[model samples]
Target: MTVLTGEMLIGFSAVRGQAGEQRAFDPATNAEIPAPVFGLGDEAEVERAATLATKAFDAYRTLPLARRAAFLEAIASKLLEIGDALIARAHEETGLPRARLQGELGRTVGQLRLFANEVREGHFLRATIDSALPERTPLPRADLRLMKLPLGPVAVFGASNFPLAFSVAGGDTASALAAGAPVIVKAHGAHLGTSELAGRAIQLAAQETGMPDGTFSLLFGAGRKIGEALVAHPAIKAVGFTGSRQGGLALVRVANARPEPIPVYAEMSSINPVFMLPDALRNRAEAIGRDFADSLTLGAGQFCTNPGLVLAIDGPELQRFLIAASLALVAKQPQTMLTQGIHAAWQDGTRALDALEGVQKIAQGEPVKAQCNAAQAALYVTDAKRFLADGALQDEVFGPASVLVRAKDFSELLEIAERFEGQLTATLQLDSADHDDARALLTVLERKAGRILVNGFPTGVEVSHAMVHGGPFPSTSNAMYTSVGSTAIDRFLRPVCYQDLPDALQHDALKRGNPLALWRRVDGVPLQA
Candidate 1:
């Protein structure tokens, strides 16, 4: 067994933090994992990590694209090599099922390989050549060529829920590294052992692939002070964060307050809403209701894209749907949440919902006997008038809890959709008969959410090129980029236009022979050269 020594991976060195110590706690047993006590870093460690990343920036970004892609693939291979030990550690730490951790490990490595392929393709560079027009009738134009460049060192904050897929070697780390930015990850407090293992995998890959020292570093820290210090550091040109709205906003504020403000791609709070059109409700209410219940409780509804709100017309069909949904929810067995803090937050949120005047509890899952951080699924119902009136009703409960809204008619449904602040995903269940109504709601939903779906739930986010796992405002800091796809690389890249440079002086992408072989837009026309 490879023993874990709770320490920070600062470049090529593993150094213990001096500020404090933390141990991973098993939410299922309500006990701490005793062997490895992680030492937490403070502002001093932050400075050292950031400085090393700065030292490594230029060499890392200018490496050959093939080597970069190979480096990513090496990391993926190393993770798969870690195998069962990784899954066991994650399961023990998170209280999630062993099967789920196994699946997430696959996802984490899959992301690395995907970004690896992305690097090989070189399309993300967006190389363009607007040739000089020396013989133009009017004024002659200057020779201009453009391609994207890395934004220097980045700070990634590991998330609590998807420890593998959104943590140390997760999408944020993978995408930023793919874009040639040195990454410094602040390991999430809940899963310190898990972070250490994955960070070691990355460190090994970097060294074996001959990547520059400080290309990656993982830190263990407590509270916002250390995290804020990373965001506020001068060397960190950008940040990628996944957490609560308050936490994300805090980093955003720090980044903004910096002398040279940088972009913070933060995936925050979202109560992904689902809509059931009248015809669909009339036809398959029971089926839709059952599936909704399953999605609501999947992974204890810890997914950021979990369907937290449902909308439908208030009629006999809707009532039928509610009955089916309530019965399905009531039959579900309670499951353990990610942490004690999350379990407590869920309790507080559900209790607060219970106190609301117009909202009514429709159903509760089978009670947990003595399981430590277990959460019983909850379902609530309220009218559209109440849902729209009380902004408190829209707050995300962050667990296996959902609110169903009864809209009087199509107009009221549209009103509720328009009222949504922002969402990661919005879904619609409809038949051909409801096409017109669905069309009317489409325009509003497009503006309100990043991804839209038909006749399906939003719990499973696809990690593909075209898929979008982001949204406006509270859902994500920037509505322009995605957090879980090929386009995610764009968040860490900035376009640079070189003008009137000699062919020998130009980078490979902008050279006259097109050495990189990237698809180039020449004089506004795209060509494969």
Candidate 2:
């Protein structure tokens, strides 16, 4: 087992950063871990990592596909080998329950193996060949072959809410590596120790698998300084980030200002909305209300897809829902949040909402005298007139706080849905008879959200091939890409065309007789050898 140290992993070497330092905190205990004071990085360290990655880009990207797949598998094995130590550090640093961290660890490893399979599958390369047309009617066409190639070094910003699955060896790292790009991660401040543990696992995996020395690196620092510097580094071709909308937009601005601008795939804010159609609310207001409370409180509502807004008709059913939700919410105890800053932000947002003219405070959980940096679950109500009139109503509270909006009728409900900013998810609690209402909402939701649900909440996001964990503008900087699943590899790749290139000069995938036996399009027709 590796000892906890405050050093950053800069390729094969572990160098202690010379910049200012900080320690991890146990939010649950309201105290610091008192060990392994983490050293923050600055432009100097970013220069070293980015330079090494530039030196290693070709060597890492041109490795045989099978060897690349094996490298990913090795990373998964190394994470598993770390075992309970990783989960324990994550729990202490983030104040997350051990069981939840255990599951997250599994997800972290699972995504690495998933990207491994993706590398072997080879569809992401998008190999295509248009054979030479020597006997065309008027003009002959030259042979053209195209395939996707990895961009250079990528910068990844670790997410605070998901220390394991979206941090050190998380989706961004796994997907970029699968696309054959070198990675540089900026560790989240809240989980420095946990990030170091996972970073060590990746560092060891790279060495053990004969990967290039600078194929991966992890650094720690303030986002404004080290993070923006990393993005502005000429060697970095793209970036992956998950955090506040302000932070994401800041990185985007830096990336665009560079001499050679780069893409930033950032998953930011979202206030996932839930619509209870007339029939569904009438049939099961109590059930929907209880489930809504549970989803709002899950993981302290730290999830990006947390249900922040609820919409329904203002009627007896809506009244029934308020009563049932109030009963469930008020009985729940306050839960420890991730950090002091986040807890304070949630407090500010809730207070501001309560101060709004027409927003009614329906329910609030038990007082938070027992836990440090804890948040009480809360539910509020307002009419569509007030909700649509105030843009502040759309602001994300970032905790277990939600507001319900009562519309006059279905038209007003649709109007409320259309008024939403970009969101990660929009959910519908509908039964068979409510399909027509759901149908009308689906068309608008398709344009408004990345994912839609039927009769379910958005708290649980499945990590699968079909999942789209991204959205437009406020939800993510780039709506075309997903930060999760197999397709995420596309974010770090670009296509290149070879004009009448001889087989001897081509890679195996583009060689004659399909040397690698991968599926390729020849003469515009897909074929497998």
Candidate 3:
């Protein structure tokens, strides 16, 4: 990967706005990577982008769905074409393996294709037209049509853990572009180089497809001030974010505190718990323990859906299996986390876990050093009764840490599942012989998470059309929308109701010509009315 020079980083105005200057640094070597950082947008630039988006939305929103879909497909092709180089830069910066970067690149392209397909189909418009009744005994029904319209400008905050899939060219930006909403992305400082590379690719695609020049913007910086200024700016109509609960909540407060609070879809982290039944514990106790340890430490436990908590029915069999499984996790070489802030946060999480009363440490990891990487590992076991009584125990630790809860009986196991906050996914370890009891527990977990698995881990999120990513609050601010599948575009749109208007005045979507031919419900029949 070529190192970006200070001169190359000089500010350039792509949209009508003026982006501010911010310095760039290399996270891997902790040295200055470039000078005169030109991409980082300030409050003034944000205002200018919003103005241009509002001006452009008048024409962009009326474009046929097929045309919009074609633009998205072009972006997808560009992403696939440059997949290898992007993955290499990602590995150089984050210290991740080639396979992981390749997988994430696939997911990013898959999301773009999924959104394009969704736009082409046009069901997301959710058009509903109520036929008019000119004459009735007492009342007359008026024609009313409803279809989703793009919010003017959206502010997207990138995540550190997923630089490619959640950064400049990630799901949020792709979905918003497909929805006809112009986007301004706040890039994470941890992966600025990766963001710049992908950002250039997107610009090339936009130019090739004849998209509006100011439609997409990428900004990078180290402090919270830039983000706060962007969110609080009046031009920003909506916000999309993925990070810690505290960071998400702070953005939420900013949006809500505004004159006109916009919707903030913040996917905060969670302790996606896996419940292991006693019967399964008796049968594959050793196997389950090993799998749990592997899943807990996968990617150094940087995933938001990492299984940080484990709930199992208490018994001698369960205890014996967990002890053997945890001890088997030999102290491996420490790996670099996403950023220094993440590393510090991991230590804070470990401190919180250690401070919990009655928590027994089954294992401990070596401390990370100044120059070399370090892996701090530990296993804390506690009683289910204590877990339920202390609400503080449910907080996510954000690393390769696991808390095993020993429930006294089957009833206590069910109670623990019910008490869990919203999560991305929940896993169940069950024995085939105990199908009846497992079903009971599975049913309880279904309501608590977006995806429920049987005898599997929740760490690997498949980027498929059938995937439902967002869950209840704390997991995500919106449960009805997902951030990983074709459905993610819905978050960038808002429903617009149309009343009495001639064909000339009506939007193309509602015009008699039915130019887009999108599916619509007219007089209780599914048709393009």
Candidate 4:
């Protein structure tokens, strides 16, 4: 057993909570780092942390937004300063490249900064005051103010693949902290070491910025008990999770079944299917094939946004494109997946695809040893009618695998796209010059996905203001909020409506006089004056 010493165990309060624990390994070397086991947290501890966070929220929420911004800035700086080491450890644990790790680190820091800027501007709080109409024709209207407030403490379940950007100091933690809610991060088992490192960076930032100590807590344990304890805990007002549909749904059911059910923003897995139209397939089948091959194989296809499914109308052009794509994928050696469980899941998925009726394996990947037990990218194809009949075909396989759906005609292709459930992204490969049916397809697809792409793959998720990284149902737990973007802060907050109140009784942002100088539009006119 490789012992974890140094900063790894520091600040982490070890409790007797191991139920079904396993050793996390360095994927590159397949060496055990430490036996990470965590079970249910003590009920008393859960309540205590909740109480502390609630008590802290009253004052913390009232703190100057500038001070809050400073805290976020401090976290961003700490992450950047230790970014190289963090990325190295991440690559060691995840088997991702330095370039990929570097990019994820940038995303993490960029997310922090985005939220910081959002809070600093104070527009996200959405302060609105409908002034009193003391006298009217029938009845008098009273002064009413509405603003968004933090929903007490939040429980964040870190994801396995993105150990940095989606774990510990990931978007959920950063957004929750910025929303004035204390956070308790449930670390991902596969990346516990990385989670701990990021946790310390967060703690250091908190202390340096003088944020409340109980405002953040990092707990580690194994099994479903810890997760059940966290979600079922009454103190946890909302949940943020990024994982499989099974795991995410469990949390949602727990929260929903609670006495006072809370929101669970679970961005469960998706196929992120890409559709190739006849015109585009005929014109640039080879180029699109290369692009899809790269996106599907990138990160060993660990990304939730991985284009696991590709749909196209059946023709010589479609056959040529798919053959070329599968060849490109087969030429690439198998890369390490995020974890053993993920590798197993991917293999199982491959087996299932192989077993499907009318499904034929067009390509299979050969093994290579850069990291842990690896699997190569595989491509499978089936007719659209069969695919539409089998709902299981829509599920995410979670590795370097892509399934091609061959449609008999353009109408069949549209029907397939319409039947797709909620997705993180949906792509349409059409010539820029082709607009009639493609435009109509875009309208239907818009209802099914958060992001729409044209002539591109869906694997690369850009962290930006314009990005909307969530969709309906299984694509995400909530469609109203985004997991990435300036808007992620919305998940951590709830609206508070105030009726005719005295000056002191009103919130500072909604006082008798507008004092925060917050961005406001009054009666369809800018308040710039």
Cα lDDT, all candidates: 0.93, 0.92, 0.77, 0.81
Provide the global lDDT of candidate 2 against the true structure.
0.92
Which candidate's lDDT is highest? 1
Q: In candidate 4, where is summed lDDT lowest over 10 consecutive residues?
A: 1-10
Give lDDT: candidate 2, residue 280. Answer: 90
lDDT of 3 by residue, 1-529 (tens): 3334211111224432134455554445655545435455566655665676666666666667777787777777877777777787778667677898998888888777888898888888887777678796598877787888888788898888898888788889888988898777887877766777777667667677666656777766557877988899888889999998999999999999999999998899788888887788898888888887777778878898888888887778887777766665555445667666777888887888788897877775545566323346667899988899988789888878888888888898888888889888888888777788788877887788888888888888777778877888889987788888777888888888877766688766666667768778877888853
Expressed as tens digits, the lDDT of each residue in 1-529 for candidate 2 is 9788999999999988889988989999989889999888899999999999999999999999999999999999999999799999999888889999999989999999999998997989999998889898799988888999998999999998999999989999999999999999999999999999999999999999999999999998964899999999999999999999989999999999999999999999999999998889899999998999899998888999999999998899888998999999998889889988899999999999989999988899888897998999989899999999999999999999999999999999999888899999999998888999899999999999999999899987777799889987789999999999899999999999999898789878888778788999988788987
Candidate 4 residue spans exceeding 4 A from truth: 1-23, 34-48, 368-371, 523-529
lDDT of 1 by residue, 284-332 (tens): 9999999999999999989899899999989999999989999999999
Descending-TM-score candidate ranking: 1, 2, 4, 3
Residue pairs with backbone atoms closer than 3 Å in model 1 (clashes) = none
Predicted structure 2: clash tally: 0
Pairs that clash in candidate 4: 38-221, 38-222
Shift in Å, residue 80, candidate 4 = 1.7
User: Which pairs of residues have clashing backbones in candidate 2?
Assistant: none
The Cα RMSD in angstroms, rounded to one decimal, for candidate 4 relative to the true structure is 2.9
The TM-scores of all predictions, comma-separated, are: 0.99, 0.99, 0.91, 0.93
